[model samples]
Target: MSSPLRLILFDVDGTLADSQGAITGAMAEAFEGAGLPVPPRDAILSIVGLSLPLAMRELAPGQDAATVEALVEGYKSSYMLAREAAGAGHSPLYPGAREALAELNAIPEYLLGVATGKSQRGVEALIAAH
Candidate 1:
């Protein structure tokens, strides 16, 4: 008899790997690119799960929609450039994560996947690098 299937979804940042440093750097770059003051690291990290536009809105409250969109674009560009510069080794996996994942993936009932706030391209690149 075949085993029943199960699914496991993972978040990218601060979960599978530590991308906070990269995120902070890109966020700062984005804010500067948009001619806005860079928010503190805690403030940037707080809205990590939000979509890009919404995150930009929270970062630059009271800003108009156009400004938020520009900030989002800048963030995306900075983040992509950073990932391209560093690659799979950019973000380190949690300790023992490789062994754990291998153990989990060995089970016929388990299937792992990702559910991150990162753009599809970002996630793919991160996966390729790390």
Candidate 2:
């Protein structure tokens, strides 16, 4: 008899990878590039699960749409540059994450996937890097 499949979905940021450094760094660069005050680290982290456009709006409320769009683009470019520079080390996996994924993969009944607010390209880069 075939075993029933059990799917496991892991969050890309915070859960599988400790991406706070990259996230906060990109946020700061984006805000600064827009001539806006950079938010506190805690504030930036608070928006981790939000999509980039939504996060940008939350961070820079009351701004014109152009400013919000600029922040989003700035963040995306900054993050991409950092990822290119750092490669796999851009966002190191949390301790034991590699082992955990391997262990799960070894189980025939288990299937793993990622759920994240990141763009498809961003997720692809992360996967390719690791």
Candidate 3:
């Protein structure tokens, strides 16, 4: 007999919303906050799917590892600040996102939960905003 599956796990970042603009903006703010030169927004966009620290390390290659770590922290700080100031109004759900979720929720056999590297607070905030 096959094991029953009761849940559907979704990847939250790009799968749920287009966060690239906000993410890149926050990265730019982080660079300025850290007194480092801001990298191109297109450069930042290429790293969107990564977790913060790994993206920083990859994007800021040739910087000291410790400094990269600090930059990551700055990025998180800037992101959270921007998030608060933006008041959860940004990060709209992707086209078809709500309709799809509603359709899935209507199915008795389906249960939805996200499997994401985002912190619980961040995920909750995102979902609530949308």
Candidate 4:
């Protein structure tokens, strides 16, 4: 007898891919561009699961929503520039990620899903590369 199909959701940030470099690098650039003091790496990483704007707000307190929005957009711009410069290949898969994906995909009973804090474009780019 076969079991019923089930969804297997995976988080992208640190689960499916190690995007720390692009994330932190872009965030630092954004903070500098916005003239806000950069948050520590630990602090930034702690909010990895939050949406970009919310993460920006937490990372940069005492700032109006407009500034936070600007910072978020600045972060996206910086990340995109860096990604393009690097051929958008920075978010390499973790060990065995592709193999795991393939394995899961091969199983007809499994439905793979990605849940990440990354932007839609970011996710699309990563999927395109992978």
Choose the strongest candidate by lDDT: 2
Regions more than 4 Å wrong, model 2: none
Instruction: Summarize candidate 4's per-residue lDDT along 48-116 as a digit string, tens digits.
Output: 989988898889888998999999899999989888777536877899999989999999999999887
User: How does model 1 score by TM-score?
Assistant: 0.94
Which has the greatest TM-score? 2
After superposition, which runs of candidate 4 have C-alpha atoms over 4 Å from their true positions?
Answer: 1-3
Q: Could you tell me which 10 consecutive residues in candidate 3 have the lowest summed lDDT?
A: 84-93
Predicted candidate 2 versus true structure: per-residue lDDT over 7-118, tens digit per residue: 9999999998899999999999999999999999999999998998999999999999999999999999999999999999999999999999999999999999988898
Clashing pairs in 1: 88-129, 88-130
Q: State the lDDT of candidate 1 residue by residue for 25-89, as single tens digits.
A: 98999999989999999999999989988898888999998889889989888888887888766
Q: Supply the TM-score for candidate 3.
A: 0.85
TM values, all candidates: 0.94, 0.98, 0.85, 0.93
Clashes per candidate (backbone, < 3 Å): 2, 0, 0, 0
lDDT (Cα) of model 3: 0.80
Q: Over 4 Å off in model 1, which ranges?
A: none
